[model samples]
Target: MKGTNYPNRWLIALAGIVMQICLGTVYGWSVFTKPLMAAHNWSNSEVTLTFTIAIGCLAISSAAGGYILDTKGARIVATIGGILFGLGTLITGYGDQIGSLTVIYIGYGLVCGLGLGFGYITPIATLVKWFPDKRGLITGLAVMGFGLGSLMLTMLSPGMIASMGTAMTFYIFGGIFLVAVTGAAQLMVEPPVDYVPAGWMSPIGKKSSDGMTLGQAVGSKYFYLLWTMLFLNITAGIALISQASPMAQELMPSTMSVGEKAMQAGVILGLFAIVNGLGRLLWASVSDKIGRRTVFIILFSTQAVAFYFLAGTKDMMMFTIICSYIYACYGGGFSTMPAYAADIFGTKYVGRIYGWMLTAWGAAGIMGPMLFSRIRQASGNYSEALIITAVGLAIALVLPLLAVPSKAKSKDAKVA
Candidate 1:
């Protein structure tokens, strides 16, 4: 592995960032919740269910995308992802035009979710191969686009909706995503098969090599432990995310008009996005220095404290600040987990292995909010949900301790 072309490979990262920015619009779903509720008379639970479905589909599709990425390569998988995502968005617009909840579920929840899964996997695994020397930092840089993507759309979507109405907003965004994602996909090709950095060494250890296929990886005890830990962390993080806009409004000090509340909540969402992006970069870079496992332990411990007190936050600004911390830890998981997976399983089949691991995220998306939604509905407060999430995070802290080292043979026995 020599003669690495530094300039061109960075272009792949640029394309990845562009692609992720488009796919990240889903994080802005909270902005649309009230509009859907007013339009269709749907309950909060029904509306939030779409988020659950979307992530679940994303998890499933990502698994398939990983397999395709490993076997078929990144370009085709990304292209297909773009097409599916754009089409799903377009059809979601159709659902909005007709004011049909079921249609929204199918188009936005299931279809577009599939696109996110495939689109997400491409850059992550590709960059791990391209930038083996900077796994944590490069992965962080590539995914920071995903975190800020929510901010971009949060700022943009409100204006689009006001000018064009909710239905047309989807149409325009769909067109943009189609063009942007396809263009990015063209640049997502794999690097030279035997490439390595100009001045670098294997990170985990001198003898560490890329390990096991998906089958073998699943068989390892570390897999289940890591998966459970990931699941708990994401569940707590996503609870706030799925409910952010409304929660922000509720936490405000005094009674206000709907417009004012919406405006302030939007600002909070923007803050979350900014912090989320920064967390990806900041924490991932930290992982490179202190190591991935250590970073996760830190992530779990910090979030556990935040979640416990979040239930008691009364001031709007303080609420945003605390939730931002939780969101940052959430973003850290996205950045840290890939690097960690590569370290453990070898980068040989990291796309697939990490995709499987993301099942925890998907599961959390589906079930994590149940407690919050139910608790909020019954008690008219998020305190119980916060306490429960905190407890979950504390439990997750133990998983890292139980992660016993296990190895499987790779084709080259080289850890990526």
Candidate 2:
């Protein structure tokens, strides 16, 4: 029998990227930190908490959203997520206008965050089924859009806030997200069951272990191992992101004006976002050839060295390069892990499986930034925190080494 021909998987991928770019707005939250602090007279940790809440919410909601994506469908979940995100943004603007931090937290952190989680999982879960032939490459591309989303924000936000103030910017962003994310979501369609690309065999055929349900995956050691590995990587990267602006300013000469410091920091943040997006594409694509385990091992090992260097470096060029590398590795973890989970657990229920796995992201999201900021606040410098981070990463290097798929039928069993 002839295989069923879908219109083009690339179209699905394109729509996924569009939705992700809007969802990626979460990564750009740092750009608002200083402005919000200045405008609202909030403390560093207080301002940072907004981003943390959003991330934590994103993780929690994604886990729930994944189950929905698996059972209900991607389009409805994505649409609702997009609407919540947009509404959240608009509400945050109102909160700012009212001088109410609580409202800001609800709008930007809780509501928008839930939107991010749902919007995030839909594409990744849907696209992997559509492109089993290029799991690593396609996932990389989708998340690469998410990484780049920050770049657009970094470039536009400075000017927007300067001209219209933070409140108006939030309102504008809310409108854009509502239209963009929801519209892109409308284009998403699940592939037919048992769909396979022409002339390419499903990786399931080349494996001894089949897909595991959410409960079965949770019951295994591999789930926690992978979860821990992702948590450590995300924590390290997110710590830097939570304070990328102030951290950069601290390293600059004292003679620089606050505006100058912010401008320079903005440049660094933009660079961080750019390399972050590209890294997802590069590292995940490489994983396809060299293997995900090797890529992760390389990421953990090298990033440990990078964090160590980042601790004591005062030279701007070296500092920026180190930050870029770390951000790239952080982005790589996001792009690679979905495919990694799919490979091990099987894609049959990846939406639900990977969504639960992202709870690590939620936990790390709260832990990473809060830990980094509180440490910096108390110690008056990020050096000690950076050093501590380096040690944590060095320890996590052993996880990927020990990570292996459970329930293999043979000792030599491997994922294709």
Candidate 3:
């Protein structure tokens, strides 16, 4: 295979960063909801349902986006994603203008969700190809941008809404995302032909543990174990995030003004993003030194503990600390998974395999929030909902211990 090195690897990573930043705006949906409700006089559940639609779209589109990325290459898929995302935002603004809930669901939920699915996949695939030697670290860095991007929007979007109004805010944010994501798409390229990282050899080239190719890996039990692990982690985290403001209100009913409650929620959410972003890097890098399986064990166990404690505590400081730790595990889980897949399955079809694995995320998107909201509605409190989340986390923690590493098919399996 002929190698091409026209675009620098760091530049590729930067492009991934840009793509994630745009994609991460979904995390800022909460900031828009209250304002939207005040302006339109919509019910809280009605406004919150918009987010549910967006997340549902994100899940469904992720599967399709993965297939597209594998077949068409990252550039075209991501460019399309950028366009869809921009249009979705623009349409969402129009939806707001018309007070049409359906338009918001279709435009922001379906279209932008499709865009997010495509945009999210490209960076993961590209970064893996570029940094084969440091798959975990590279994946961590690229995905950490996704986590941190939420922090950025959490800080910026509220002020933008205050000054510019909801429709204008969407228009501006959409345009900015379009420009940034489009430019990032232009910078994306597949890795060099027949290129191998320095001081590294293919697992097939050396004698080591046999592992499956991407195709074979998916068929194995370990794949499902990893899948379940991610599903549980994301479900818990999303549930917490979806109800963040309400949770804060419940905790500090007397002291917090509505604005203060929202601000505090924003702070907690931002802190989650920060810790989540940093945890991706920190945990994935640690996986390199300590081993992936070991790291998974630690993360899952810690997450279980955190979730258990989160259910009992209404203390703001304690809540923040516990949730932050949980977010770290959430972020770390995402960053580590690609490398984990690469470790077990070769990069031959890492993108597709990873995409398939992300079905866990999509499925969890539905289960987590649905479970939280439904249970809260039925029980008239969040405590029962949280306890259920803790149970889910505990269930997730068991999967890693039972996980069997992918077997090597050839010497190439060892190097990966």
Query: Among these predicted structures, which one has the highest lDDT?
Result: 2
On a 0 to 1 TM-score scale, where does candidate 3 land against the true structure? 0.91
Give per-residue lDDT, candidate 3, residue 99. Answer: 84
Q: Total clashing residue pairs per candidate?
A: 5, 0, 12
Write one digit per residue (lDDT tens) for candidate 2, span 301-377: 89989999988898989999999999999999989888888777887788899999999999999999999999988
- Model 3 global lDDT (CA atoms, 0 to 1): 0.76
List, residue by residue over 1-416, the lDDT tens digit for candidate 3. 22534567888899898888788778767777667777888765677677777777776666677677767788987898888888899999989878888898888888898888888888897788778778779989988888888898777766676677778888888888889888889877776546665556655453222235556877788778888877877888777776765676567767656666666677777877899789989988887776666677787777777778788897988988888887788888888888777776666666677777887877777777777777777777777877777776676666766764534323222212
Q: Spell out the clash pairs found in candidate 1.
A: 209-414, 209-415, 210-414, 210-415, 347-416
Residue 140 displacement (Å), model 3: 0.4
Task: At residue 131, give the lDDT of candidate 2.
Answer: 79
TM-score ranking of the models: 2, 1, 3
- Model 1, runs deviating above 4 Å: 1-7, 203-209, 253-255, 404-416
- lDDT value for model 1: 0.83
lDDT, residue 205, candidate 3: 59
On a 0 to 1 TM-score scale, where does candidate 1 land against the true structure? 0.94
- lDDT per residue, candidate 1, 97-198, as tens digits? 998889999989999999999999999989888888788888898778889888987887766776778899999989999999988999888766556666
Prediction RMSDs, each to the true structure: 3.0, 2.1, 3.0
Q: Best-fitting candidate, measured by TM-score? A: 2
